[model samples]
Target: MGVCFSTEIKDKSSFHTGVDTDGNDHSTNSSKVSSVPPTPRSEGEILQSLNLKSFSFSDLKTSTRNFRPDSVLGEGGFGSVFKGWIDEQSFAATKPGTGMVIAVKKLNQESFQGHREWLAEVNYLGQFSHPNLVQLIGYCLEDEQRLLVYEFMPRGSLENHLFRRGSYFQPLSWSLRLKAALGAAKGLAFLHSAKTKVIYRDFKTSNVLLDSNYNAKLSDFGLAKDGPIGDKSHVSTRVMGTYGYTAPEYLATGHLTSKSDVYSFGVVLLEMISGQRAIDKNRQFGKHSLVEWAKPYMAHKRKVLRVIDSRLEGQYTLEAAHAVANISYRCLSIEPRFRPSMAEVVKELEKLQEPKETRPRRHSSHGTRTRRLSSGGLAAADDAGLGAYPRPQASLPSK
Candidate 1:
């Protein structure tokens, strides 16, 4: 596991000054394009450096049926994502579903903030490839238009399946939820375990997309940053992420490490268990923060069951829930030092996949109960690495 520090440092000026009280960032469009000098390489050179496919705007337009509204898959601050089609071999435009399906994300030309994010997505996804990570097929930058094309994730974002309410939504079963969690962990583990570790600063349910077979893939590299190198323990950067999922330490101080991603993973795991948003304004005042509200219950064996999603009442085995909750608790330790690395997390979760008869021996924790948790639980590891972590002083955002 990575090291951590809890010393209270002087607060820095707000890096997200352009962000509104509601957490919406307005800086993307405020700055002029020419204000910031271009890098040494030209735009074309930059794309070439990544060895990425640069598609003509005309090609993408035809693929998306001329950007018809009916083809839209999802829309956000960046722009709308359209369901499109292209030839599998030559990448030519094709009739919808008659050839390879693609998701074309067109950026809103007016939003300057999205340009940097768009380039970051292209550069990173273009350079890295993993089964658990979303695949960027190509990009189009023509005139005032900026866009990205990716392999279509037929099932869409995990956020929709986890929180969106409607008849179209079918609650994910226990096995499926575990599979998604494990896949996402592997994605993060791969990034953190890379030669030059990459910190996925933004880790949330919405960033996890699903394929037709229910396989999970991590998407969106807009806020990802390179980890600290040499002797440096952490990297200092401007705060950026969704309201509820940001780590308390990272939120208080701009210092970031791999543990920050672990903290975010814990929040998403909590969401999977309780079927609740990290921060929901609709919830009562004290109950608005899922992590805060769920913590008390998670500490107790009987009460922990209360936090499980009501939809999954009879679906999962009692032992599996206990194991998952234990992992979440460790990942969410207030002190980063106590949190296990993504690799360790993968091992613990894999144990849950084994049949009951072949499972590891049960172990006792803090005299709470004798729970069988993958040979030995993370609770023991925390005992060896625990450190003090000051509680965050910032009031939780209602959004």
Candidate 2:
């Protein structure tokens, strides 16, 4: 779970300002869109929102088959997510494998931060409806118990698909990676475009879930914060997020902005191209930081191939690789002012997906041929003499 420093209740601000790193003002909307309601201050007021259902604790228990171990789908800092069945029309509990399937997250009783996170999830998801955001079907709030119900995502998380090594978890194709990246970018763009401007504090690959057709949807809003209002430049809050993905400026100062989310997005994008964790201690010397080790290579057209996942086997064109490198480099800029807005990033990614003629592959200075290591591992070695890097083991808990 994400760490929280302020003990104060959630902010009650009515509106927020969204200034991109490049000084573009995104907070204003000329379209005649309905204004969002002010955030509810209490649990009672939040639960009263008409968009969500109030599920009795007993009903969820029955739906999840008494929270049996066999029904568990995944586990995380919040708690275990159990596969459950519910009636589509009445939203009533049903037998296993019957009716609509849902993922029920039962909060851990011992987690001190679980309640706050759970409330944040409901508060944000209840009011927002978008194709890229996870759907919250209902929530159960009983004395000393907190649980949330969500539409089940069949393909699991992008983290698993990109990092996990197994027959069930296939490597994401280059096209699929671009698709997921675009979907996630659109989701952040939606949050930033909101009249009240929500800063998604946590944006690592683990929080990006995938559906049956490989469509990406963002999950986990526990660390989300309302953007600064009025003339304030940013919302001052405690630094809280996964270590490698957190922006340097936010880590130094408690000031938070939408650009912080942009930095995290850059890290995820780099991970997709390299098939490496943001910070892998297991890596050899001088190669632990994905951004540090790969950014220089990304600067040059031919050298960029050095960092591309050898697993890709040159399936992606040199031009497309260079374009992605440019985007990530801008996003991971030391000065936030140099980074492009999410809207701009989305437009750049869309250009990559447009139909175009296939061009002949450009051979790198270091030959483009890739060969398997003798050890029967998935290591891919090229003529450049880059050493074999082991595949990362699954370290983070699933959402």
Candidate 3:
């Protein structure tokens, strides 16, 4: 839910980059400053009331047959997402999937997300347009009901395919998995490299929605923040993040920065490659966690292959697997400085998939299968024309 980092949106110290996010200049760790937040049009109010161009409740209700439970697509941290339709005015072009099918996310009034979070979602997703980011059509907020309209993702979330109970879903092949990783990486890089950096506070399998082709669309920007500019290296704030994915520095000290997002991304990447949950409360004692179990292997670089998902056995090239494992190790490194930037990660994955003409490598050629074990416990293995991942074998639950 938190992508391992948990937080409640606090009243920021009067910062605004536009209608989307606000920056705090006068606020500090010791100084508590509060002023009225910038009054901006909430996406819901604007779409439903301000614009005749948007779909009305009656229009959506008629199409959805009065919000029938049968039309409900799925439920998540926000609320239920239902499949509904809109006329040509909503989406021109042509009709393929039932005339502009939209996803209606009904917010839980009793839940932790309130008006501010709802407004933030509308402001950001409403204007933020990208093929990889989920499209926000409009919203509706009346009385106890708060709803966000988004583009329907037919294939559902990556989590459903990865780790739903009793779900005998089709396994993601090596190439397809790599492709998904690449696409998701591209989305992260875009956000990090935007004119103004946007920190994705929550990044996990559930947040990565997949369309019919399994393309990733990052959703839920309730916790998205404007990163520090100029000489500012960190954003000072109380520690508010999920447990497993939170950076040690952020958790130990309230120094928020880009590295915090990188740490979460690393955990997500590890889960993608290995098909493991970041934290498994049901796991016995110490074994109930992906991070705790994989840390030893990442540090030493021996037996890291043992952590690879058994379901993918032999489906992935040894060299490719080793390179990805090595990258994952760097991503999960406890120190933020040790982790590679998102751009570096994208490059490594692209290289691991192809040859040096596109991306260079740590090894001269792939498939060498020669492992060099250093005294420090780093093992480098080559199976493709890429790099080596030398990690110690850390024991985990059996297949």
Candidate topping lDDT: 2
**Per-candidate alpha-carbon RMSD to the true structure:** 11.4, 11.0, 11.7
State TM-scores per candidate: 0.79, 0.80, 0.72
Residue pairs that clash (backbone atoms under 3 angstroms), model 2: none
- Give per-residue CA lDDT, model 3, range 1-399, as digits (tens): 111001111111111111112333433232111211322333334433332224455555665556677666554444455666765464432222467777666665654434556676776566666777887777776667777777766555565455533322345545556766777777777778847476665566666766656577787766566667789987665444444666777666656677787788878778877777787777778767787787676544346666777656545555666778788778877788888888888898887665325433223223433232221220111111011111111111111
Q: Per-residue CA lDDT of candidate 2, range 194-248, in tens?
A: 4748888778887787776667888877668788777888877655566578788
Task: Give me the overall lDDT of model 2.
Answer: 0.70
Query: What TM-score should be assigned to candidate 1?
Result: 0.79
Looking at candidate 3, what is the lDDT of residue 97?
48
Instruction: Write down the TM-score for model 2.
Output: 0.80
Residue runs of model 3 more than 4 Å from their true location after superposition: 1-54, 88-97, 142-144, 165-168, 299-302, 354-399
Better of 2 and 3 by lDDT: 2
Superposed Cα deviation of residue 57, candidate 2 (Å): 1.1
